[model samples]
Target: MAAALELFGARDPDDISIDDVAAAAGASRALVYHYFSGKRELYVAALRSAAAGLERRPPPAGGAGSLDALAGALARYFDFAEEHAAGFTALLRGGGAGRCGEVGKIVEGVRGELFASLTRRLPVREPGALLRVTLGSWIAIVESAALDWLEHRDVERRALERLLVDQMVATLTAAARHDPEASHVLHNLKNDR
Candidate 1:
């Protein structure tokens, strides 16, 4: 499973084969077949394995108390992407519209977790239609930025995390302008931070 996870993370699913996974794991192709139904099953399992421990590794709030929750989330996420660069990239880029149903669901499940986490931390009273859209948009923006950061490696991770957190704060601040409840939420966030 570890070998399969690394290979799937590091290469396109099409580029990898049962033979490759077996080779990586120092097992025979027949043995691999005994464990997994087939390639697709193994590939999806690899993705699931890679994502297993990531959902709970929230970043530390140390020195980021000003933007505590947002900062913590971004820092942990940045670290996860950096640590599993290949898998993270594959999950975001490969699992898309044209992908297999299971693959797409796995990808969207991770994304949905992200959206849910951020929305939960937010201090909104009644999350409206626009607010939901806005929160989802923020998730998209942060994910793209993290992918870019992983590929480029030019910007420092801390800088990237800071940029994303600030961008989100600005977005919420702007939203607060037109929404009284959002305004209250923003005020609470500011005071709490």
Candidate 2:
């Protein structure tokens, strides 16, 4: 799986073959075939592996302010992003295997899980449309920033993490003005700190 991820990361999945994965893993082609019926199966398994690794890390400990928790989560996020650079870029940019049937589901599942995890940490009883849209936008921003950071490497990781967390606060703060629920959530965040 690691071999497949490395191969997929460096090049498009369509360009990689069973032989490539076998050679990278130092195993015979037959062995690779024995485990995976074909290239697509192996590719999906490798992507599932990557997704699992990213989700394995626990969110920041309880009682940490929402902002602190967000910072911690973003740090772990960037760690995975850095480790999987090309694969991460390919996944978020909707290129390569990510567009395939199973692959697309996996990507959407990851995004949904991430959205749920972050919002569950908030004090809101239920997230209304305004807050939902606000958080969704924040997630998009993080993905875009990660892609840009991978391509340019101009911003330091820590600075970028801080910037993202600030963006979240700024976004929430703005939403609070028009949304009472959002206002309550923002008030809790301030008090939590």
Candidate 3:
């Protein structure tokens, strides 16, 4: 899997051959085929393995139910992003992730899980459209910023995380102004302040 991830992380699934994976793994091509029926199967398995390593250090002792808890979660996430630069880049913002339906679905699954996890931390139990959209936007922003940080190292990881959290709060406020339903959630966040 490590060999596959290294290769796939560097290029698209279609570009990588089973022979390449086997060579990198220091295993026979037949052995690689023995484990995975084919290249696509191996690609998906390796991608899934990379995604699984993202298991966070369980949020703060309290939970992601508060901004404080979210900061902690973001810190852990930022740390993961910093440490797994190649994997994070390839899995999240990589060029070919959206090309293949199978890989795209895998990427979407990971994204949905991330969205679900972050929302579960919110004070709002049943978020409305505006709130949901706002949060989703924030996640996208964080991903974009992480990509920039990976390439540029323009800011400290902690600073980047804090910047994302602050922007999310600002987004919540804007969402509140535009949507009555989101306003209520914003009120809850403000009350926490």
* Top candidate (TM-score): 2
| Model 1 superposed RMSD (Cα) | 2.7
Clashing pairs in 2: none
Each model's lDDT comes to 0.75, 0.82, 0.75
Residue 187, model 2, lDDT: 80
Highest lDDT: give the candidate number.
Answer: 2
Q: Could you give me the TM-score of model 2 versus the true structure?
A: 0.93
lDDT of 3 by residue, 141-188 (tens): 887888889889978777788888788778888888899877776666
Error of 1 at 155 (Å): 0.6
Spell out the clash pairs found in candidate 3.
none
Per-residue C-alpha lDDT of model 2 across residues 5-108, encoded as one tens digit per residue:
87887787878889999999999999999999998888888877778878887777646546677788899899999998756765665447534788788788
TM-score of 3: 0.85
Model 1 local distance difference test score: 0.75
Question: Global lDDT for candidate 3?
Answer: 0.75
Candidate 2 lDDT score relative to the true structure = 0.82
